[model samples]
Target: MSGLLFAALIVATPFLLQAVSPGDANWGKLSEISQAYGAVSVPLSAAALAGVVASLAYQARQTRIAQEDAHRSTHRELILLALASPALRPCWEPPFVPMTSAEWERIAFTNLIMSGWENAFRLGSLSDDQLRLTLRGHFSGAPARMHWANARDSWIELVEHGTDRRARDFARITEECFQAAVLAGPGVQAADYFIPEPTNGAGGGGS
Candidate 1:
């Protein structure tokens, strides 16, 4: 029970005692009432503690979701950047066809895209499955696969020279996607195994 309720009960004790024995004015009834009401406090305190724990757990879950959303937003922005910026296009550029282009522009774009992917990984924006799906878009054709195959050296280079583990992280998945693309060969299209999630339409293989 609340302190105010307990206090009110205590205040009424004198009247109860007066009524119990008007002439004797017994005070023992007041003691009994106080003990009875005080016993309710333990259960009340436990319930209050449970409520606080539940509230904190809810707040922690909300905070975790907010952070995940922020990371996902960052990843989405990176994908959208590829849409407008020629330097950051998600698909293979011209002259490369179904594979990596020897063209300087395509190489530069690949480098930039991989760097962004590394950052996204470091930020915990993309899960391994999401990253795999995102990488699938780059294997749009022979040129895309060629680009990944050709860029393998540089991806390793970044891992070797990087200060953070981000480059290493990207390199791990980069190798996986590049190998998968190579194994799939020129016949394997982006539509073959690429299904985009609705949450990130920015560079979804579907898009």
Candidate 2:
């Protein structure tokens, strides 16, 4: 309503000026200008309304994009934090996570080490690329499957029903990607791999 009124005022301003401006303003010319202004006002007002609508639409789009970027940024920060400390890796190995799971099984993890993986898995959006890398590149397959199977009930309780869809799918996708990586092994592109349904938490369990 305000926008329409402002536009109407702009269109009306010129006619008002010509009509009221002191003396000697030809009445004949004033009448002609009034007619012209009347003819153009509606189109000018419509254009103004369109500009307002377009600005609102643009602002809405930017707001959504900002939210998504913030989501991804949160995941990135958590990934960096999880990998920051050397104390988390006592025995040493390249590219921790999946291998860390094996290392953990061989010689159980202290609470500190366990915490690193916890932040890596739980802090950010699951679909985040870094999170996916931590899952598929570092921890997928038998290791992730085994861990998830053991923790399923606890995780379900944590997430409950209203949890974010990305986080929920993250749990399921990590397990699937892990199985796929195990099947593919070295040299095959993981993307070329197919995910197998979780198999009864089969094979064996490790610490």
Candidate 3:
């Protein structure tokens, strides 16, 4: 709006000068001033336009990020809901060996946690460093370690054959963190897990 007003004022300046001074000498002077003003205003107008374009591009990127965050949040909510309801469990719970009902629920719960981390990593909510740190902390306990041991083969298969590169990277980083935690010993603190090396697109065997 300001740019348009500035352009309008520039356009009207010559006419205003002509109205105020009707003589030929004054008209010649007005023409000279108009030429000089046009030269200066052209660059200024271009700069204003560029600024508008840049602002619009920034807004678009922010909107995209907001949408992605909302989508990730919705996914997390659905996972939690599934965890709470047995009927919904089949929707997300992966196949596993036969176990007691209590054991199945525990395994399913752990799987949801892992899936949530994977989703966050895939959606850009968790940076590679954040994923490594969080996964190491999570797998520092026995339950998470047991869950990964049960699920490792399928996850490794996905990393080897899945079309999604982001998922593959997530699996590799997660496996590295899990392995680091294992090497740190069962009762070690999460911080005891060694800093992960660069991802090698491979998974480690379970103990």
Instruction: Indicate which candidate wins on TM-score.
Output: 3
lDDT of 1 by residue, 150-180 (tens): 6667558857796656557677777888778
Q: In model 3, where do residues sit more than 4 Å from their true spots?
A: 1-21, 26-28, 96-132, 146-175, 183-207
Cα lDDT computed for each candidate against the true fold: 0.67, 0.57, 0.78
Clashes of each: 8, 5, 0
Q: Which residue pairs in model 2 clash with each other?
A: 98-138, 98-139, 140-178, 141-178, 141-179
**Residue 155, candidate 2: C-alpha displacement in angstroms:** 12
Minimal lDDT window, size 10, model 2: 106-115
Model 3 Cα displacement at 103 (Å)?
5.4
- List, residue by residue over 2-79, the lDDT tens digit for candidate 2: 999999999998789878797787878878998999989989999999999999999986796578568756755544
**Pairs with steric clashes in candidate 3:** none
Q: Residue 51 error for model 3, in Å?
A: 2.6
Ranking by lDDT: 3, 1, 2
lDDT of 1 at 94: 42
Which of the numbered candidates is closest to the native, going by highest lDDT? 3
User: Which portions of model 1 miss their true places by more than 4 Å?
Assistant: 1-102, 161-163, 187-207
Report lDDT (Cα) of residue 11, candidate 2. Answer: 100
